[model samples]
Target: MKQSNFTTWFKSGSPWVWMNAGAVAIAVIMTLGLLILIAVRGLSHFWPADIVEAEYTIPGQPAITLLGEVTTREQVPTERLQGAGLPVDPEQNEFMDRELLKVGNRDLYGADFRWIVADWLSNERYPEDVIAIERREWGNFYGYLLSVSHDGEVVAEGEQAIDALQAAVERASGIYDEIHSLETGAIGKINTELERLRLRERGYELDNALTADRQAELEAERAVQNARYAELESELVDLYREFNRDSIMTRAMDGQEKRISLSAIVRVFQPNAMGITDKIGHYFAKLWEFVSDEPREANTEGGVFPAIFGTVLMVLLMSIIVTPFGVLAAVYLREYAKQGFVTRTIRIAVNNLAGVPSIVYGVFGLGFFIYFLGGNIDQLFFREALPSPTLGTGGMLWASLTLALLTVPVVIVATEEGLTRIPRSLREGSLALGATKAETLWKVILPMSSPAMMTGLILAVARAAGEVAPLMLVGVVKLAPTLPLNANYPYLHLDQKFMHLGFHIYDVGFQSPNVEAARPLVYATALLLVGVIASLNFAAVAIRNHLREKYKALEN
Candidate 1:
């Protein structure tokens, strides 16, 4: 039997199909690999590794005892090590291995890490008594607990000191938490109330409504608030004294004894003595701290809750602003407008906007939104806070609006495509039933196309959540002292600058003075950003799927 052309083509299979499949496989593999790498590097940071005590010696220097966790190890060329001003043996192998030890005693040694050649280390020991102290100010401290004290007098010594120290820390931490709540909650509320009253009084003056009765009422309220504040202040003073009452003595690797106040320590644990279960518990505790606590030590230590909160809030605000605007524009273009040269031009422009570089949007947002629009707003409404700039500067509001504008094209294109996919028969059927165009669009057409609209929103959110450059130019800061949303009136402070995880990664990776310390945090933060974006995308996908299922019968 002779082979026909159709048989030959079918036997060979489709080149385009094979090529696309290969491309997709490669992309999937790359994405999975990247995510795995980020997860390993980031999540491993919380594990409490065993601490090593080693005696290190150099060719010309005396031996010194080093105590720390071995963070990393790498092979280096002997010539490179020599070039870096380290002593290396030329007679030995061409390559030399070195270990990076996190010998944290920043306040004592002035450095948190040190690199030593593998050949120079000896007598490595993992002592059960070796303690790692995570502090509030200085970095981690590796030492031995010598004694527990109160008011400059020793109360417990030896192993008993450890128990005493833990108990005291627990009590002091409770006191600290109470103090923080009083200061930032109750006291903060009073301050916010005072500020609101001041602003209201100013507004009254501006409106020429500061009547004598109103003035008396304001004064009486102020007096009551002042009296309450004085009572809180007295309580705060007592709490502070209680927090500072206990202290502990520690001996460093070099036998240098020092007294560390309990208030300075956040957590103390002997990692070398921990079993699998204890290590697991400690890991969870550390992870919780990373996600809930405020960053300390120039953002090299502590948690990233602020950055996470800001990124989510900004993305949500952007979504709210973009969805309506995008839907209206897409609806007009695809359904209401005449399909002519002008409409085509507008559609072309919208598509082109999506291709514009993100930084260009950032620059435009800075110039037009901040300088022009924001400046006008501040001048007209906030003259009392003039020279300080109020809304005349970059803020969360401008950042959200800027991102909405940047991502609107994506939403428009997706929604238009969705609207285009609806059958003409459906539109005709609704119109034939005596429905007007507007009523048909609102009641019938829009409901069927909701899945597509959600698809656009999903794309917009994916892009906006990962955006750092535009956010930086508009409002993102390295550290925000307060979150944008709080318990105060109006609740959301749109005019405040805020932190973002994407920008946090950038700052911690590039802008930080401590590269070694911040590198792991970069991976951790990048992983977090990916998870956040994925979570948001997944939610949108679920909604779209639900809408698709609901409207499938209508399409048929």
Candidate 2:
């Protein structure tokens, strides 16, 4: 009966054991898969592709060199050849071309080429011409011409000069019309009056009543009219001079030359040799540049360095603000304070604070921090920085304080756990050695709990680093022109609004209309954040382990 009972019990328990093991195995597999996927996708962004050349000919036009795959004329469809306007004998084209080429698999015409089209013609009727060729077979007779031409300039200054000259001519035409109108109206009127006066004088002479006074008056009027005509003539001459085509063309050409020169300089400065690897390298380089450089207009290129600097500075400030208060609260509650209704209530409050919605904290931060504390600070300490509203507005210092408040519970809980784990006998032993309670707590208890304190700090840092909602209300901006730390009069200005990576991810992912382009960046940033937090946690754990080992003997 005992042997039967034992068998039954083993059978019942064995299934449960297998089930638990299976569950663990599945979890392990899933974790490995997730990690592998992340690494593969992230690192694949840096792979490079081979560059190739190909030739294409349009009938009646010179062969064009394209950088990509090469293909044989025979392999290319007759319709495609016809579309290119190449004369192909429909009956013999296939067989004759195939025999003439005698293309082998190893031949250049048969080789594959990779190319990106720099230019393509677009028309609905001939849609094939407009399509970009990513790859092509190189064995064709035309395939050899696709190599990059050393003489091909990306932009032609001569063409730009012609464009500018055309613009200038158009402008001059408008001015010419104005000048012509003035000349016709004023000068034509003067000429007509002169003719009328001459006619009147002829009549007077015929009547034989032409007096000296009349002649003098007529001469004076003629002289005045002639002066007006001369003035109009001079103005027209000036307008013609101003609108001179040669001068306008010369200026336009000069301006275009200068612009092209600057553009060439910029291009020269840019690294032009691009491969997949090179492109990925450039992306990271640019990201670093953005983080390190000063902020500029969104359309311009500059470093987002100010935002990065501000974010780091603000988080550090928050750590400074939260660490001492949280640790002290935790120490008092776990060690010094008696377990009572007040202590229980305080613990409840701390837990509740952790659960409160972050957005609610943001609202509270905006109202209480920006308006109440900032207003008071502005009135007291930052009166000189008024009108700019240094302390009486959203800023880095207030943002840090708000975030610190939000993460206080995380630090408190971690620190309290660290404190609770300290053996009571350690305190008793310290007292037996004639050490005072305060001294025992400081020297023995605090030292042993150092790892827990570090753990708390790490947790707090992680929470602060990722908190975006509170930052939005407190001081985080889409862009910050200057860093929080600078050589300006008072270094480390706390009143500046700053940019943060978490906020940046939010802005780029949600706020931006271009989701496709920003999506990759969002993933990259998220990966970076996770890496940073993981590294911090690992470091803290290492320290904790070392401390635990050091205190292992005392635990007994």
Candidate 3:
């Protein structure tokens, strides 16, 4: 009876089907769980959490007052805490709850975070008068507003200080904008011209053509640019003076007063006093800034627009580069190559290359592309920039090419599979009707294969966006001084080094000096990277779907 029952169940095929369905369900649940965890830990960082003021007492130490935001909490058995050298009375408590606070006056407190026993906390309050200041240099400042001053004199005190300080910040912000504009715009133009003049003179010398007329022209241009530079410098000096004219005084929990320049401040907020509507507005504003601003403080704070731009730009360049080469190679192999031992061996090699490590491709690109090809180009055409190694360095161009090399096998294999799907009757019919074999393949075969090519591209993008190890050796950096793309001729600067979101996550998560401060940013950056890759894949998939629908008639 048991043998017959087993035979009947096996013959029904329901067991195998259930097993496959169960596996798929498990995968979906795991993926959603990961995304939810990432979202909660990352997106919640932008919200304006209420600050807590409390008194903490520990055994054998003086009772002290703590002022900051409660970032996290942990519970431990009293016996375990005692074993770890923390004095906890097991008779009084079975478990001790500890709260981690972000006490963000780093310059004053030596550290921005502290953990204390929550059971001992007393006089806990959320004071409405507390202020939080975000700065360009120091991580953050938390204190009570003391006074607002301008040029060594007090402008406002008491309840009016917040209003006065906000007005000063507005004026300082305008001046800061002027400074940035002058530096990046007019002065930047003059600097570029000066650089061009220098490069032109270098080229002439390298070519043995630095004649008297060329020398005179160079000097004349240099003098004009220098004069313009001097005028901009004078303007910059005045702006700096005005920018530093106002200051705000703040008192820490321990009653230590600090005078911070308005120029250094990014923003100031009274979180405890803000209503829910105000908090929501501020949260959205912060999210926008996170997506738009340049990173500061070792990439622990600020926006990652440069990284986002670089990742997208590099992937697009790789796509532009890989697609054509992959298609051509696949076409020759599938449609033109003689099918024999050599062809079989070449096919095996291509398939093997797909499994080669990405880092090996990065190394190959560095040696062959940068050192060999790029070095030769620099020597032949850019001799003037030889020592500076213009193209002969790991940069955006080489990075993209390396990724293209790494992902090209996938494209080739996919394209060949697509080409194979072209019905033999279509090719024969087109050839018989007056089209040559080339015309038949180009007009009838390639169009039907485009969807597969797009599928390959989607897979390539998904892999490339998350790659960090290869990029680190190729061109990615901890911090990029300037963006590769800017307001200049030939706006896409291929030879410039760039940042990647994947690398950003690695640096913030592992290389940061302040682990506690960088933890949230790492999660946020990781989530952003995942979103970016998914968006690219979705775009490619959409195109593939459209192409498939368009060419479905031909396939039939």
Strongest candidate by lDDT: 1
Model 1 steric clash pairs: none
lDDT of 3 at 477: 88
lDDT of 1 at 533: 97
Pairwise TM-score winner, candidates 1 and 2: 1
Scored by Cα lDDT, where does model 2 land?
0.60
Better of 1 and 3 by TM-score: 3
TM-score of 3: 0.97
Report the number of clashing residue pairs per model.
0, 24, 0
Question: What digit string (tens of lDDT, one per residue) describes model 2 on residues 78-193?
Answer: 55545555565556544222211111111233232322221221121211111121111211121111111111332212334334333444565567567756755567567768
Residue 547 in candidate 3, Cα distance off native in Å: 0.8
lDDT for each residue of candidate 1 in 118-138, tens digit (9 for 90 to 100)? 889999999999899999877
Candidate 1: misplaced stretches above 4 Å?
A: 1-13, 203-215
Residue 51 of candidate 1: its Cα lDDT?
A: 96
Structural similarity to truth (TM-score) of each candidate:
0.96, 0.57, 0.97
Model 2, backbone clash pairs (residues 3+ apart or across chains), number: 24
lDDT (0 to 1) per candidate: 0.91, 0.60, 0.90
True-vs-predicted CA distance for residue 273, candidate 1, Å: 0.8
